[model samples]
Target: MIKTIAAWIGSYADHPDPRSALAGKIALVVASNQPFYPLYLHWIVGTAAWPAWLSLLSTPFFLAVPALARRHSFAGRALLPLAGVGNTVFCVKLFGAASGVELFLLPCALLGTVLFRPDERLKSAIVAALPFIAYLFVDAHLGEPVMMTSDYARLVALNGMSVAALIALIGLLCSTQLATREVEIVTTEIPGARQHVDISD
Candidate 1:
């Protein structure tokens, strides 16, 4: 079932370039994760937290990443980080700094790094910097909690662990891509070396 779901998600990332494909997959995965925030909010504060459920408004924009990419790859790539920053900012406003929702900016920054090709230095820098800038702005200027919750400790831990898990998942994807590239490079550099070493036998 997990494999099936992964394959389904990967279908949207059907670009020839491995990096672009990776970016597409990342965009879809991150976007798909957003709707769950309302569920988490409901769990933490019960079902009556209607105002907090407003975070779900960002899901469509996130889901639009792939559709926009199909029209223009740059648009899709650009939207991922932008949508992320927007979503995170809205979340920070809804829950405030104490909820640790701002920690999500870390992954948003990381997304910017991996989403763009190496040639797009300016775009990458802008996308990556947006998250850091938002974090600073939020930390400094955020006034009060829009949605009050007594469970500060739980919210902090939840957001922290959630961010950590996302980072780990992204790290695994990056490491896997790197390893695959390395293997391809080695295989290309070697001439008939595999034929001489029949490890399969």
Candidate 2:
């Protein structure tokens, strides 16, 4: 069943790197969106504590993941910072402190390197990390609980989403850096010079 499912999904996941990246994006989107379903169920049943808009507004950030996987420069460049800031703020607001949900900021920050080309990585990385960096500078010390309504169940759900998102991004990072060049090695006339190895698609 596993192999069969892999084969089936392999059609959409064309290349190895993209396959991994796509998996990560899908996992992020699913994880971010997952709570909405349950929350909506409770909302319908009139038992939800959290407002629906809190999660609803975050949809665009996750939705950008697919475009990033497609190598859309705008999406890759814009999304990391957006998600990082939005999620980090939400974490502090919802839990009234530095909750573990803020952990996803690291992976989102690293996406600057993983998702973009060399030319864009630095700028992307700076943007991705700036929000968290600014937060550290402004609110260096913890304040009194702001939204003290967070419960154990909510914490578990938020942490679980962060873990799942991190695992997916890690998988993307590890999926056999498809050699951008051939396997053969050659000598160069210049001392300490590296030979350029040609790669095929």
Candidate 3:
């Protein structure tokens, strides 16, 4: 069932018609234009919360994963600084504060790299899950009695939707890469009759 779902998603991504792209673009625009844009408006605009800062810091890394996978090395490199700034801001926000929240970007960044690199199936699976792990941690922190509220619920929903979109995008990219690799493999194979030098001896 999982395989079927993955294949169906891959098919949609691999052969995305104009309509699909348009719909995707439209959705993104709407999501971005909402009264509380998930990343910036809700998390950064009015909040002095440390967790919000941490969330902002992590955003660039998540955003850049797709471009990195597509071999956009320069852009990927550029995102590192933004990610760093986010980390710094988070650190400042959390200074002299309780350390109950497990915070580490290294594993996540490594997983992202592994996922983006070609021919690393196990690593890709691990990397694909990194975001969810981070999400769980964030959810735990945000769902604490002190942090939970009706407004926070909306923020959680927005964050969840953003994460879902990121995951879908990554899956689409990996599928496209796999399809391209398969096409190349098939194209390069020589038929029995087309072999120029056949040595059975």
Q: Considering every candidate listed, which one attains the maximal TM-score?
A: 1
Please report, in order, the local distance difference test score of every candidate based on alpha carbons: 0.78, 0.52, 0.39
Clashing pairs in 3: none
Q: lDDT per residue, candidate 2, 33-107, as tens digits?
A: 656643633433244335434645666666555456457544644664566556656655544543455555566
Runs of candidate 2 with Cα error greater than 4 angstroms are 1-48, 65-74, 138-146, 150-161, 172-201
Q: All candidates' TM-scores?
A: 0.84, 0.55, 0.38
Order of models, best lDDT first: 1, 2, 3
- Sliding window of 10 residues with minimal summed lDDT for model 3: 95-104
lDDT of 3 by residue, 62-99 (tens): 34433442354333432433343344234323421132
lDDT of residue 40 for candidate 1: 80
**Residue 88 of model 1: what lDDT?**
85
* lDDT: the better of candidates 1 and 2: 1
What are the per-residue Cα lDDT tens digits for candidate 1 across 1-201? 999977876776666666666667776777677678778877888754556778878878777776777787877777877888888898887888888888888988988888778788775687879998898765558677688878888888889998998889889888988997887777678997566444643
Query: What C-alpha RMSD separates each model from the true structure?
Result: 2.9, 7.6, 12.4
The whole-model C-alpha lDDT of candidate 3 against the native structure comes to 0.39
**Candidate 3, which segments miss by more than 4 Å at Cα?**
1-150, 191-201
